[model samples]
Target: MTQPEQVTFPAARADATVDAVVARMRALDAVLPARDGVAVFNRVYLTVTEEIGRRLRGGEFPDPRAATALDVRFAERYLTAVDADAAGLRPPACWRPLFQLRRHPGVRPLQFALAGVNAHIGHDLPLAVVDACRAVGCEPADLEDEFEHVGEILVVLEERVREELMPGPDLLQLADPLTHLVGSWSLDRAREAAWAAARALWALRHRPDVAGEFTDRLDAVAGLAGRMLLTPLGHRTPRPR
Candidate 1:
């Protein structure tokens, strides 16, 4: 007797919250300007925060309060990631961006945070988008424009955050370094980083046994960095607009 044919199951859809957050981020990048990468970071920050709130309300986390904490925690992590990536590059760019970033007294810390966040988030977000697109049988290249849109939103958010949070004498000086950093970055590099981050996250998602371990490690790194860079700032309290 002939053996029956075997069937294969389709890949599972990505988590809805992750998809929603990435989609919104991509949208923000579309309208982002070349000189405004920080804006994209800011929008992603707010979007992620809101999503965490939603997930908490829906009881998606073991401790609902953890969701709220993640909102702020991730924002700082994103910033740190961007800074670390930029620092790793060689000269004549080595530390040039960092030097420029230091020019803004009031806005420097925030800009540093945003840059770090962008570098790190940019590394992974594109990959996630590409994977999702592929899962739906779409070309990853098609998502490039969307990624740029998210970048734009990040710039806008950064500007708005600065305007609201640090409207000090040197506030406008922040724009110069930001413009320089954006101009220095190539889209290709951003795309590559995105691909890496997405694949890493994808791997973590599929391996349930290690997912907690991976997140715990990420949390530990982020926590250590946050304590070093963010805890001293004491600027989490959003200024009234």
Candidate 2:
């Protein structure tokens, strides 16, 4: 698989900022309990959604410059968090069962079960923020494109995490954190959290005024969600076949 291009910033400070976000995410992983992975993922995701809802409903932009900073921070935080998790080898061999389950007869039902949830949390909500930006004569096109780019990055991260961390032996073993987490929920809760965080960041980008505070909070949320996505603790496999 093609790796994402090296993330670079225009200035030294920007690069440092990105690195800091990555560091923070990495730190979070060290402290999280293995058992509470799903719960943590849900909380983070919910927080992201709540933040975005706040901005969308408020319709105010106080500090455009600060908002811009927030946008960059959020983007960096998200990218770094995912990248950091991808760096770790979690489940040790998660792909074997993931591949097997893909062909299962129940896969379609599983996908459908989570489709609405993912759609609202991932696509629709972010798009709404993009629409709001367009309505306000902001550079919606560029921001939307950036959002799409981030999604692409996320897909790559997920694939890598699956390949590296999934259990190879006894793919169905209960001790396999990746398999257990992915197969536990009807639809993976981590996806919801990631989507919610993405949507929230998108919404915050449009406001630009409160971006700083939003970015700080989002950094924490995204970090948690990213861990869930990478680690077996909170992950749910794509619907059963």
Candidate 3:
């Protein structure tokens, strides 16, 4: 399949069922270049969505309704970003760096994947929690277990992705710049920060101004980390398959 110049998801589609989100991701996988930075992350995220869908179908979640709501809401954030980019509007700061640096040849696929992870975990996940809460008419504490379960799965996936994308042992010298760059960000730290941000946002739900300000600050900081993650290494190496 030829790669689409941009992935577009309508607002209506944002509220589509989790199966729809899974199908959308599958379509993206078919169209996007495997080596493209965004595509790299897309593949990882697709895996995650597939797992979530599977669990939902298997009746694994104690509260399937809440889980589905959380899953769909979480997915909509990513789709919204893609739609914004397609329309030439700026996506959230958390996502802008990945979209901007996506095509840079010098950036490794691993860097792109991790940068995407950074943005999603740091910014989108917290907001998704709030979205899910509203959709389910519940509080953050009610969905805490679901949140942690999803996050734990992501952590495992991140480890596997790192192993899969790791450069050859010889290429990973201690002094390599990639080492330092990748080392600077930790997913554990990002997850902790996300939980804190979610609690803060939930507490400020009645105060739009303060909540918006907090979100903007979070976005800016996550974007900065993403920018750092995408720093071109000038390696001239083709992105790993």
- List TM-scores for all candidates, in order: 0.34, 0.32, 0.92
Quick one: best TM-score, which candidate? 3
lDDT of 2: 0.37
Error of 3 at 155 (Å): 0.8
Q: How many backbone clashes does candidate 2 have?
A: 15
Ranking by lDDT: 3, 1, 2
Where's the lowest-lDDT run of ten residues in candidate 1?
1-10
lDDT of 3 by residue, 1-241 (tens): 1125566655745357888888877877787778878789989999998898898889888898899888888887887787778678889999888888888888988899999999998999999999999989999999998888788889899988878886655554455788778888898899889988999999999999999999999999999999999999877444456
Per-residue accuracy of model 2 over 50-70 as CA lDDT, tens digit each: 333344345433533333333
What local distance difference test score does each model get? 0.42, 0.37, 0.85
What candidate 3 gets wrong by more than 4 Å, as runs, is 1-6, 12-15, 168-171, 236-241
Ranked candidates, highest TM-score first: 3, 1, 2
Residue-wise C-alpha lDDT for candidate 1, range 51-99, written one tens digit per residue: 4555556775553332333233333333333334334423112112432
Score candidate 2 by TM-score against the native.
0.32
lDDT of 3: 0.85
Compare candidates 1 and 3 on lDDT and give the better one: 3
